[model samples]
Target: MQVEVLSCMRHPNMVLLLGACPEYGCLVYEYMANGSLDDCLFRRGKSPALPWQLRFRIAAEIATGLNFLHQAKPKPLVHRDLKPGNILLDRNFVSKISDVGLARLVPPTVADTVTQYRMTSTAGTFCYIDPEYQQTGMLGIKSDVYSLGIMLLQIITAKPPMGLTHQVGRSIEDGTFHEILDPAIEDWPLEHAMHFAKLALQCAEMRKKDRPDLGKVLLPELNKLRDFAEENLPMMMMFGAGFAPRNNNTYSNSAFSSSTFQVSIIFSKQQPYFFSLY
Candidate 1:
């Protein structure tokens, strides 16, 4: 049954299955060179911290991929397990959802599945697991949303979801959001930080219905983040104290007149200066 489902599935964002061995119960998939988000985020001395914009992009990509799975035809694929460890990244930093081992296919007509997948073994990491799913045996798309929300929080704050001293509920209520943010991202723009934080909060809502669907929630937040990055290009470049032009072709008068180009040049100088500080 798992093999049949894997064979039928096809999506640009999803991890493509190359082949499966029935005898060995193994599946081959397109390799993600960057490995899992967990490796980069949690592992030490791997690379400098992932920038907020890149983090948002990865989050958005994962959301879109999951949305495609949920809305797939014939039946929506329910990834009962989703966490940073399951999110694989390519060399270019494009993220793909992998490890469908715990996935459940929900047929449109059936509405829900009755096969009763056991939850005693811990379906997902402790921090990323939905509170509702932990309490109730019922597993659905909302479970994935909850996990994504946790991951969004992780990206913005740069901290593991569960390891903080305070409880998630208390920290949220006490307005100590900064306490949860990752220390490495010390100078993250207030606006971008707040935006992603709020979105994460909404996704982590105790009530399932209160949370926005992946389409409504993740995509819009990601778009806004992208726009923010574009707008700040000049500032980033300017901080670097002028960058060496990679291409000889200079901007035309018409191109210079455009807002994006203007923003680009404004920050171009800062690019070289910005990196020197580090």
Candidate 2:
């Protein structure tokens, strides 16, 4: 299932599947030097904490990949499992969505305005799974949005997701939103972070219908934060105390276009299956 889904999809922010051996059920992918966002966020390898700018950039990149998956042709795919561990980072710290093994292709329906599927079982990480989908078998693209919200909050707070929404909500209500931000990042832009926090809370809403549209509303706001990060990269470097910006290529808005992604497949007698990534 992973091969079938990955072989058909291409996006800059998505992990590139190099090859697969169906006989062994093994899949190979491009090596990510920086490992997963889980590692970076928690400094698992004694690595420095991620700068606010980088965190914002990664949030936007993950959103871009997830949006691509939801907007896939023929059928939109829902990534049932979306968490920090599944998000990888390249040498340049470019975030990419990985581990689509639990992804499902939502069956299209003409009568319904919102697309969803009824499943017998729910699959995803605790705290990260959509509450509505977990209780009910009905899964939709918004399920992924709920996970994304948890991720966004984690990116900001650098804390575990368990009961995190309520914590942030209380902090906001008590006029302590800044206090809830990750202490590792000492210089959070309070107003911008407040706006971001509000959005995250909306996405984490228990009701799926209450969530904002990922592509239409969420993506645009995240993109603004991405651009804000880019524009302030120099300042962050100078004032961010031990923070260093990478030499990554400037993020291209045109990357959302299908023309920017290309998939090439190869068949051979010896190899079970292969996909070439440029």
Candidate 3:
């Protein structure tokens, strides 16, 4: 199953499956330098926290990969196991979806038949799995969207999906969503952060019909958020307080000391990037 699914699909954001030896139970795959997002996110002390920029890029990359899988030619594929651990990162911090052993292809014959796929076996990570599909065994592209939504929240908050669902869901209900944001991110534009987080919540809704279409809804929003984070915000803003204005449209920053982020870089009319001393 792994070999069949991996060989059939090809995309820049997907891990290339080179070969597999069933006799040895070994699968050859494209080498990922930075390793799985699981290690990068869960093992904080052992591995550095991925900077928000990289995290945001990886999130969008994973979404693109899933969108491709869910919209593949011949038949749409469902990656039953989609999670941070299954997403490998290259040297450039590009995210590629790995581990397709549990993938399923929705054939064209049953493409329009939503009530058809009622499998007894349940797959995918518990936290990232869709509640509706898990309860009814009625799978579709929306199930993948729900899982991706959980993964999105994990990328944003650096918290596990299972725990984050409760913490973030409660915060969203009580209007305290900012409280659960990962402490590693010292400074973030609240409006932007909430925009992204709320979208995740919508994707992981209990009802599949309530979730947004990946291509039309979620992807555009993610692209906008990624652009805002990557293009607008300075690198220094990830670690300290929000950007403060100086004279003549110049911007100043605060200080910080951390593994992935350090020092303050101020933006000025004369110097686009200038180091400031604490």
Task: For candidate 3, report its TM-score.
Answer: 0.80
Work out how many backbone clashes candidate 2 has. Answer: 0
What does the lDDT read for residue 55 in candidate 1? 72
lDDT of 3 by residue, 89-191 (tens): 7766678898877777776456445513566788888988888878989777888888888888887787867667678888878987777777776666778
lDDT of each: 0.62, 0.80, 0.71
Backbone clash pairs for candidate 3 read none
Model 3 error, position 13 (Å):
0.8
TM-score of each model, paired residue for residue = 0.72, 0.84, 0.80
Q: What's the C-alpha lDDT at position 21 in model 3?
A: 54
lDDT of 2 by residue, 120-149 (tens): 998989889988888888899999999999
The all-Cα superposition gives candidate 3 an RMSD in Å to the true structure of 14.5
Candidate 1 per-residue lDDT over residues 1-278, each given as its tens digit: 44455455565556655665555566666667666788778755566566655676677777877877776555666777688878877656677787777776665454234412335544666787777778876566777788888877777665777743234446666887666667776667765776777777778887666777677657777767766665555544443322211222322111111222111112221111110101
* Count of backbone clashes, every candidate in sequence: 19, 0, 0
Better of 2 and 3 by lDDT: 2
Error of 2 at 172 (Å): 0.4
